[model samples]
Target: MSIPYQLILTFISGGIICVIAQLLIDLTRLTPARILVLYVSVGVLIYAVGAFDPMKDIFGAGVTVPLIGFGANIAKGVREAVEKEGLLGALTGGLTASSAGITAALLCGLFASVLFKTKSKRM
Candidate 1:
């Protein structure tokens, strides 16, 4: 596909996914964290069923920039590990695939905590 069309698709798809998440937030009691986990699980299921490739192809970054993409990445890593390391890969593949993103988040949070003053929310 051409770059312009891909960009357009990405914008629309990303916005749609966000809209669905927002609606879930508004309509359901589920926390945002749970919703995010759900998205990742869904992504993993889709990837396992061989459905996520077309999504990645069409939605590109729209599908990939979110937690669902992270799940797909985990699933992919697990598949590779399963090929190379058998059951051990099933245990460690997701963590191995996701460590960079996890570490980046941790480091960023650590930096922010050190640099900024903490304020307790008044509820």
Candidate 2:
């Protein structure tokens, strides 16, 4: 049996993204939070330059499952909202587009917290 080409591409793309993050962690002074913000900002910039869709087409979920994808989704939502709802879209579009994911994250966190016991780390 042969692996599908798309699967290979997806793996490579996602792996590369992860590798970059790992390298940042190993080599840089920047905190993880800053890296996360940087990635999301880069995503917005990519979308602003009209490159996100083509990259998404090529990379599939590899491009859409990361923080960058979240950023792009927000940009996309805002753009569509602005087109349909005028100025108000700017205020609501990102949250509107991201609501489902946000809700899922919240629900999952709630479930996890209820199911597990936590201890404070002694740092």
Candidate 3:
């Protein structure tokens, strides 16, 4: 199937994010996981405030294509649930919506452990 523009944009944006984060990691002492968490948290907070919607509208899946896209997805899902279920949505919507990201991360980690030996360095 042909890739849609939205997805293309998402991939590009996501790559840029990763690249920037990688650069930050290389230049500073922060770890990759920390940067990833920071990016996701910022995305979530921005999304919760309703600012991320316009970016998504303009860029389509482009904005949602990256790791932080999960955060946007969570915000979007929560907003929709809140619209339909009110306070109850607040209880489960975000987790339910953002499950894909979490699952992906977990699966990847499991795969890495099975495939590679990660020994901590003892100096």
Compute each candidate's TM-score over C-alphas: 0.91, 0.88, 0.66
- Output the worst ten-in-a-row residue range by lDDT, candidate 2: 1-10
Residue-level lDDT of model 2, residues 48-85, one tens digit each, is 89999998988888888988999999899988999999
Q: Per-model C-alpha lDDT, please?
A: 0.92, 0.88, 0.80
**lDDT per residue (tens digit) for residues 6-34 in model 3:** 67766776677778888889999789789
Extract clashing residue pairs from model 2.
none
Model 1 agreement with the true structure over 1-114: per-residue lDDT tens digits: 899999999999999988999999999877999999999998899899998888998899999898889999999889989999999999989889988999999999999999
- TM-score, model 3 to reference: 0.66
Q: lDDT (0-100) at residue 73 of candidate 2?
A: 92
Whichever of 2 and 3 has more lDDT, that candidate is: 2
Better of 1 and 2 by lDDT: 1
Q: Which one wins on TM-score?
A: 1
Which portions of model 1 show Cα errors greater than 4 Å?
A: 118-123
Clashing residue pairs in candidate 1 are none
Count backbone clashes in candidate 3.
2
